[model samples]
Target: MSMTPIVLDARTLKALAHPLRVQVVGTLRRFGPSTATQLAERLGVSSAAVSYHVRQLAAAGLVVDVPERGNARERWWKAAHDVTVADTRTLDEDDPDALDAYLRSIATAITLRIQQVLGARSAMPPEWRSVTDLSDFRARLTPAQTEELTERLHAVAEEYVRQHPESEAGPDAEMVSFDLQVLPDLDVGDRS
Candidate 1:
């Protein structure tokens, strides 16, 4: 079955408000499938708590149980989506507080994960860390140029995925994360 993409309504957003749940979802998205025991071990939580949260996620339609092959007793679960989101503007205008909280939570979770990942891998492969500096610049462009640029960037990502299809998640392959968020840069003076 095709994975169901997660679109956060107010309720689902509230459901994922917890940091652990966000981490759990990210883990599932990265690892493909994991049992509660595995998650508990990874997160340093009890299996029972992991099981309970897994059920909550399943009930929220964010995750689903996948049948295990050759292991009848193992309970394997997979994320319902390859992509999950928290765009509350799609829900309603008056719920900015919920959206803000969701964004902050996701950002915090991602930042923590990045710190852990980078710290654990003291030396990244040359290819992965060849460029330690970020190149950030602003440009003035017509609407068409902006649209074309966005589409081209998206195409590059799609091509990358097509060329290097994700293998089954395991110890040999690490999940790398990329996050791009566009918001007003408060520290920067108005460029316009």
Candidate 2:
């Protein structure tokens, strides 16, 4: 499978702006192919609502229909790509509103995933629990330094996973979420 990230354009940015659609695509990517009804049950949403959003995702080419996996009763769907990128330079200049919504939706979805893991942390195996992280650090750096930091972090993160996808994972392995955000806050400690 291709590892290229889907750079959001006007059409795709608008298509994935909704929170439900964002969650749908995320679910497909994380859990693999699934039917609308199955996704609805997993997400605690109505089947009709999930179906509607899935159709929209398919229309925007963010998802694809798995005809071979489907029978007469239900249709299967999977994410078209493993990643979706919102290039701040292009999107911030072009469609800021849609860009804001799409990014916020993603942030909300990520927060939910964090919460899910937190809730299940106590029941996790000792090995997994030992490696769990929910921490942050602060630093002062120039824009160029920040860019270099991000590139280096991505390189380190991609090292182990590049050759071993979830499909090729060993029996003792489990799918994990590894998120990286290098946001620059110009207005730190300014509430107003």
Give the alpha-carbon lDDT of every model.
0.72, 0.89
Cα deviation of 12, candidate 1, in Å: 2.1
Best by lDDT: 2
Best by TM-score: 2
Residue 121, model 2: lDDT of 95
Instruction: Pick out the ten consecutive residues of candidate 1 with the lowest summed lDDT.
Output: 176-185
Tell me how far the alpha carbon of residue 28 in candidate 1 is from the true structure, in angstroms, after superposition.
1.0
lDDT of 2 by residue, 1-192 (tens): 348579889999999999899999999988899999999998889999999999999999999999999999999999999888778789989999989998898888889889999999999999999999977777878889999998899888787678667768889988777888788776788544
Model 1, range 97-142, lDDT digits (tens) per residue? 6677767778888778777766855578766675443346566666
TM-score of each: 0.72, 0.90
lDDT of 1: 0.72
Residue 112's lDDT in candidate 2: 87
Clashes of 1: 0
